[model samples]
Target: MFKYFNPNKVFFITSKAPKYVLILFIIVFTIGLIESLILSPEDYKQSHSVRIMYVHVPAAWITLGIFSTITLFSVFGYIFKNPNFFLISKSLAPSGFIFNIIALVTGSIWGKPTWGTWWAWDARITSMLILALFYGIYLLAWRIYQTQDQAFKVTTIITILGIINIPIIKYSVDWWNTLHQPASINILSKSSIHESMLFPLIIMTAAFALFSLLIFLMKYNTELIKIKNKGLDRL
Candidate 1:
């Protein structure tokens, strides 16, 4: 079972993704945005400001999700000596970094209207800041290293070490008396949010996931092409 889902093989296979996958991603993402932003109802308390959650929460989720993915692939690359794993993981770093920044900005914007402050040293916010910093360092390793192999080694190490923060971000509210709200939509609990609001939020989260996957695949393909062209040049 474990061997059935290898990251190296998965990356290599997706490098040749069919054209339809791209088309489907575009269609689904567009529909998701429409349903989330236009069709959804406004919150009773926050009014239109609640729409920010459609964007903010999804960005936060993707930021952490993508980083965790990169870390897993980085570990696989290190243990299996798989170039594909490293390449895919490296390609994902920029997208994850961008989402992290988006999440932070959107969170701050949302906070101003709700929390009455643009910024706070809350555990969730600070952990996200740290997550973004980790992404920057990971990208810096690629830019600073002279060789691809050296960059991969260093970045993989950094990615693996950065996994420690994933839990911190998730449990930050619990660990500290933070201003951030506790989880209201966990698997264990029936959603504390109203259906009117929850529907849009779910649509937006799905859209964000699709969009991130689309970008990740595109970037992964671009990296593969670069590697191939470099090999050809050497030849």
Candidate 2:
């Protein structure tokens, strides 16, 4: 459950990723843009607005994935007595929050044309809003607390407890009579989407994942520098 990793080891690994990762991201993301905008067929019902799925779905996926991973990292850090996980979680929280906002905003944009409203209190929407709240709190803990120990204690506990919402968020449309659509892609079963749509979805998801990694690494390196500075001050 716990992975004991040195903070410096993280910096070392991510430092090597910049040039290679960015180039690959650029290629894939450009292809993703073309696929979503020009190549993919318009939905008969939703029409062109259906294109929002490319960005909205990927953002939703990243929102859940990042939060769940942060919870796991928080748990491991607590169990292993490694603050590095907390630092990583701290770095990741902003990206997660950003994507959560994107998902909701884009969902609202898509909903206006399709569902006739900017917001709905469907199970999925409610849970996603809850997640955004927690993500805000998670980031605030790091900023508001004067000590890392205090911040970590609060954040680790909140993240571990709040992650319970992820499964609920994923399954909300299924469990409740909701306006939100059920997942088009199933991990256990084959995806329900056409190959054309699915291909772009995959590319966009990869591009987003790589983009997120770049963001996290930047924040992680900043945190490492701050920690180093603090250590020097103590000396």
Candidate 3:
């Protein structure tokens, strides 16, 4: 099944994906903005400031999802001795890191009006900051290590350790006192959020996911090109 993971087999398809993805991203993003900014009802308390959720919530969700994906790929790459998996993980990190920062910044902006402060030591906020640091260290490991094997081993370890923070970030609101609000969206049960707001949130998340995919395709293609030039049979 994994044989199709080969760069030679997938390069043609991957190379052609960005333009189509970009068009879809533009369409979805435009709709999401219209729905979130104009159609979605304001919070009874927060008013228009609640609009920040359109960007912040989706960015945070994508950040967490991408990091989880990176860890899975890194672990599988190590176990199977498949360098291609590591390459995919490497290609994914930039977008995840970017969205992580977006989440933090937007959250801070949202916080000022909601929490009366721009920064806080709240559990969820601190945990997310920690996650960003882990992302930084993981990216730096790749740059600082002298060989592919060394970089792979170090990054695998970093992700393994960093994943411990994911649950902490997810549950911090429930586990302790925090300024951050409890989750309005729930997967196992009915969400507290109204359909009026939930619909736009979903669309925004799709737009962000498409944007992340676009970034990954570009980075992956660049790596593939480098491999082609270096005469590597697989990456």
Highest TM-score: give the candidate number. 3
Model 2 CA deviation exceeding 4 Å by range: 1-4, 232-235
Candidate 2 global CA lDDT score:
0.88
Per-residue CA lDDT of model 1 for 1-235, tens digit only, reads 4454454456567766635566776776777677777888887788888888888988898899999999998888788876667777887888899999999999999999999999999988998899999999999998899686797789988987789999999999998899999877888879888787787677767767766777777887777577566764210
Which candidate do you rate higher for lDDT, 2 or 3?
3
Off by over 4 Å in 1: 1-19, 232-235
lDDT of 1 at 169: 95
User: Between prediction 1 and prediction 2, which has the larger TM-score?
Assistant: 2
lDDT of 1 at 138: 95
Candidate 2 per-residue lDDT over residues 1-235, each given as its tens digit: 3332666655677777767888998999999999999999988777888899999999999989999999998988788768878888988989899999999999999999899999999999999999999999998888899887888889999998799999999889899999998888888999888887888888899999988888888888888888888784210
- Clash count for each candidate, listed in order shown: 0, 0, 1
What lDDT score belongs to each candidate, Candidate 1 first? 0.82, 0.88, 0.95
Query: Sorted by lDDT, highest first, which candidate order results?
Result: 3, 2, 1
Point out the worst 10-residue segment of candidate 2 by lDDT: 1-10
Model 2 error, position 122 (Å): 1.0
- Judge candidate 2 at residue 3 and give its lDDT: 31
Residue-level lDDT tens digits of model 3 in 88-160 = 9999999999999999999999999898999999999999999999999998998899799999999999999
Ranking of all predicted structures according to TM-score, beginning with the best and ending with the worst: 3, 2, 1
Global local distance difference test of model 3: 0.95
